[model samples]
Target: TPTAVASTIKAKNYIKTITYDNSQEDFVEKWLDQVFSEALQIRSDNKFTDEVPQRYEVPIIGFDCLKSATTLIFMNLKSNKYEIIDRPGPRSCPIHIIVKSTENSIHLKFIDAKNYVSADMELDDFLRDIGKVEPCESLIKESWLLLSAIDNRIKDYTDYHIDLLQNASLAKLSCLKKYAYCYKNFNISSCYNPEDKANPFDLSMRYWKSKVNSYNEQDKRKKRRIDHNITYDDYQHFHDVFLTQRCHMCQARFTYNNKPTLDRIVNEKSHTKINVLPCCPYCNNLPMTISNQEVYDSLRNDMRNIKISDCAIRKPYLRIASQLNQKRRDVNAQHHYKWLTLQQIIQNMDYIHVTDDDTDSLCLAIAH
Candidate 1:
């Protein structure tokens, strides 16, 4: 270890860097080869370099090492551990972090062997300049999910270690739960880290997101399919029919993003003036075969009874709901038969016989 530390000085490293997270391993894995390429003779090696750059001629101050390197990595690195050499600090620091404190002075210690290399400062000048680091756990979780889904370990400090260092408080490494995840791998006795476990949250937020996305897509598609007679002004007029956007069938007040939608009084009919109501998506989604008048009558009666029922709102509300349920079924039966009649007329439109006068009137209307 001492010889390794001494070798860095022999290597003629120029600028040094100190980091607070696990970036050393990444630097060595990614950047080391590009710095010291082939044909460059290392100082420790006994063999002669074949293609030496023709700039310098000496062995220790030779063109071989000179061409290859101006800096070196002073890192003591191994599996899950990295330490900076000759730096005065605790070994446990992955990325060095020190919170600001009240006491005026700091014990300035940089080099262990040299006494004159360090000096104390009254202010934490470096921290004073660098502002607060932004924590982005959601972005981290997104990436982690992808890696976990593939059952892959994070390849570098940039992949996971930086996030861990930043979000030190909410570190839920190797999450066992579906809602949360984390990266910590050791001493995980009971909890399974969701970050480490890929398929735990169904391995597919995208699928569910797409499913939810279709709702909005369907609404847009519905608007496009509106009758040619129903212009933008007609839509504005329909919206003005309601004092507030409320569900016609269930009478649920439209709130949040539940969204106000248009419902046909009868599914067989188009969005004519008498055939549509402004309602909640919940009511529109329910394929009720009852007329809007029946729905309104049932809901209104239920509301009146609910308000004046002498009992507290909570206890007998279900009774009013129950009474309306029977009335709805009766109304639904009547509307269903009427809807079938309309369907038959629609189906027989091409086959139905017409008088010469009727045909002439239809042709003239089409021609005009």
Candidate 2:
């Protein structure tokens, strides 16, 4: 790895040197032309500074040119910097980096993570910061959870911190187990099995196609162009997310009640890789008229009443499901009250006339 990085740096330096040489020659020629035109003599100091700037050979670590497509962990020896790139999406590669400024301090800024944690902060402070970020707070959490799994001290902070730590750890354990293939020889085709009906990739493809057909039919009826331009590779990435077994929207484990549904994060967007995420059916069914921010805001509001738990359904998810259950109960209660009121009104009435046209509607109301 060092040799490869050295060769790469050497090639880059050589090209830079050639360009610098050409530019310097041009400048010297121009200077000489001016000097001769004015009859001037060149002068220079005999002494040259002996001090030489230190140079560090770049040491590329834990990075494979091909295998590191998903994640890249490497160090720049010259800058003494560490970087972690997570480009899990299919259509684009968003960069994530960790910069070290002092021996005891590091600054982390990750777009996918959506938050930064300073190494100098106390454990409590870090937890406090993590609590502020809602929904898919950290890709770095996977690494931190793995560390906590190995070393218990990292998670032995406080009750609240431990709850958050365990939530993330369990998410990592439940979701990341699917990535068992050898990265160096990983074949995307291996994820799919034509004969296996239970295969997630196949299931996702079927679901994606059904949705595409459904949407296209609706759009055609409305005289709008079919906008679902999602590719097979994009759907495959959605399946990879499904293999995580957690809802990307609410971080809930996939269960019978809460099956995985591939959905657009923003309803206005097409089913592209970056726009799509694996969420539960309930979240998938959220009103399309709502803006992405409004949808998340509603979920966040529902999440406020829930506390972090060790269950497969975490706080943010359970709250929404519970809210649905509560709404169903409320509807039932309202129907029962209306039915009783109708019965009382009928009992108080004298002979009433019933027409054939109103009979079916009346029976349906009575049944409810």
* Best candidate, TM-score: 2
What is candidate 2's local distance difference test score?
A: 0.33
What TM-score, over all chains together, does every model reach? 0.19, 0.25
Query: In order, what lDDT does every prediction score?
Result: 0.28, 0.33
How many residue pairs clash (N, CA or C atoms closer than 3 angstroms) in each of the candidate models, in the order given?
13, 0
RMSD in angstroms, all models? 30.3, 27.6
102-137: candidate 2 lDDT, tens digit per residue: 332223222221112332544334334443322234
Q: What is the lDDT of residue 61 in candidate 2?
A: 14
Worst lDDT run of 10 residues, candidate 2, spans 1-10
Clash pairs, model 2 backbone: none
